[model samples]
Target: MSLTSRAATSLARQTGRQLAARPAASFQQHRNAANVAGNPNESHAHVTSPFTRGASGRQDTTVIPSFKRYRAGNEQGNKVFQYFMVGAFGGLTALGAKDTVQNFLVNMSASADVLAQAKVEVDLATIPEGKNVIIKWRGKPVFIRHRTADEIKDAENTDWQKLRDPQPDSDRVQKPEWLIMLGVCTHLGCVPIGEAGDFGGWFCPCHGSHYDISGRARKGPAPLNLEIPAYDFAEDNQVVIGT
Candidate 1:
């Protein structure tokens, strides 16, 4: 071989060895860079999309905060609704209790009135003729008289048109022998004395009123006659004053 040809061959062999060493070194460097970048403690920025899933295959990290806010709002709303329900129920109960108390009071008042107006009884055989007997009934005085024949005749013969109240004798008595009336004067609610008036019926000293035997007001300031009590004859000698 010639000197020039040997020199060219040695140069080509050195170039091929260098090229092969460069490829191996470059591959090792790329592998080391990839390992360093994949380390967990490295300060590398992770770019994940908003719609991407997490490790548990659920929604992204933002979903957790949104769910917590929704739960809080629901809890607050539930508390407010509970308070409103309690207030409405209490108001209804109070109204019902008030109505019940008012009804009880009204019923008690009516019962008391009914008990106060109980019936009164009187025996006609105990009363003497030409005399008057005063009895108490319903917190007021009632006058019962066994009228004489002469008194009845005088009462029947009186002129009813000239009297102050103008009531006939026939309307004042259930029986001709008996005359019953209330003792209170029609003028000012004053009680009258029986058989002492100018007309021989009743006299009111407070108002200077007089009544006849038929309970008709004669010379008086009274505008009405003596009132006849509601009475019924249960037997011949017995009478019920109230019905």
Candidate 2:
């Protein structure tokens, strides 16, 4: 045979051998992939996961697009936020209601100075001699009296035995007979009953307080004299309760 023909024959045999080995190599690669996928109990286990590249040039990486977890977490967070908003709104509404009720539903209160300004006028003809007329002045009870000769004599002649401070010469009273004083008791603010011709003063029923014709507290639980309201006689017989 010729030299070129022998070389061609050798090359042909090599090509045939390579063609037969190609299938065997592919089967071995597939067997390795199958073993990696199925055998979980293997000691040196190499998993053929979707996140890796295979030796056969196959793309094992898979882009799994699923919004299930995101949607579930978002729903749970939305529920929590909704509950928080509802609680906050309820608290604000309750506070607003309380403020409205406090501002508008309660009765208005007046000052003490306004109550102290009330005054009234009394008729001079109504008050008789040796008697007193009760009148309201500056939210307090006042007594206007027309003293008789007997009562005035009794008040002046008595030794002031019923008085707390026994100073007759000190001139607490402006008039000798005519007395105008507050009818309220000095201790606890009770109205005293005006008496005449005996003790010559007012007698309190609550605590048995006694006052002279000049409204000086003479006996009982009262601490001081009955208060005298500021007044001026408008005429010979007319008297005003307040200044």
Candidate 3:
């Protein structure tokens, strides 16, 4: 054969061989690309995921969109709960304040009513001479003694300066025969028995205090005379005990 023909035939064989191998090479390349896509460690060229670098220099993937939506819903629900709690607290506080104001008003009204009706009246015509009568006036006991002539003379003749708590018998009575004073003893809050003392007037057995017919503290621990109620005679026998 000629040399040029031989060379051309050889080249054609080589081209045919290369063409026969082309499909296998193409399939091998496609398979390599699929393996690279399936591998977890390899980075994709076309697709990218959002990531952030942390302080440790590691990449952190973004949270899923569904998780972000759920978090936002939770935050909104929390805000609603907080608002409800605040509203309920405000309502309770207002109710408590209203109750306090009402209670204060009620107490003030009751106190005014009590003070307005504190005065009392007493009838003195039933009391006999030289005898003692006890009456209630303004929630305290008042002693009313209708003195006999002899008792008045005895009380007046006594020395006023020699008594422990000194007062003239004439100063204690608006009418000389009527002796009116509180029944409470000056030494303590005990009530005294009328006309039963060493002074022939009132005796407190609880502390052994003695008062005279004129209600002056004569002996024992009593520091002052018996308190006299503010009284005025409405008539010859009727008296008003308190203003």
* Candidate structures ordered by lDDT, highest first: 1, 3, 2
Candidates in descending TM-score order: 1, 3, 2
Error of 3 at 184 (Å): 0.5
Candidate 3: C-alpha RMSD to true structure equals: 18.5
Instruction: List residue ranges in candidate 1 displaced over 4 A.
Output: 1-102, 105-117
How many residue pairs clash in model 1?
Answer: 0
TM-score each candidate.
0.57, 0.46, 0.54
Worst 10 residues of 2 by lDDT: 167-176
Q: Which 10-residue window of candidate 3 scores lowest in summed lDDT?
A: 49-58
Model 2 / residue 131 / CA error / Å: 1.7
Q: Which 10-residue window in model 1 sums to the lowest lDDT?
A: 40-49
Per-residue lDDT for 227 in model 2?
78
lDDT by residue for model 1 (33-53), tens: 888788733533364445446
Where does candidate 2 stray beyond 4 Å? 1-119, 160-162, 166-177, 196-198
- The lDDT for every candidate, in the order shown, is 0.85, 0.72, 0.84
In angstroms, the error of model 3 at 95 is 23
Better of 1 and 3 by lDDT: 1
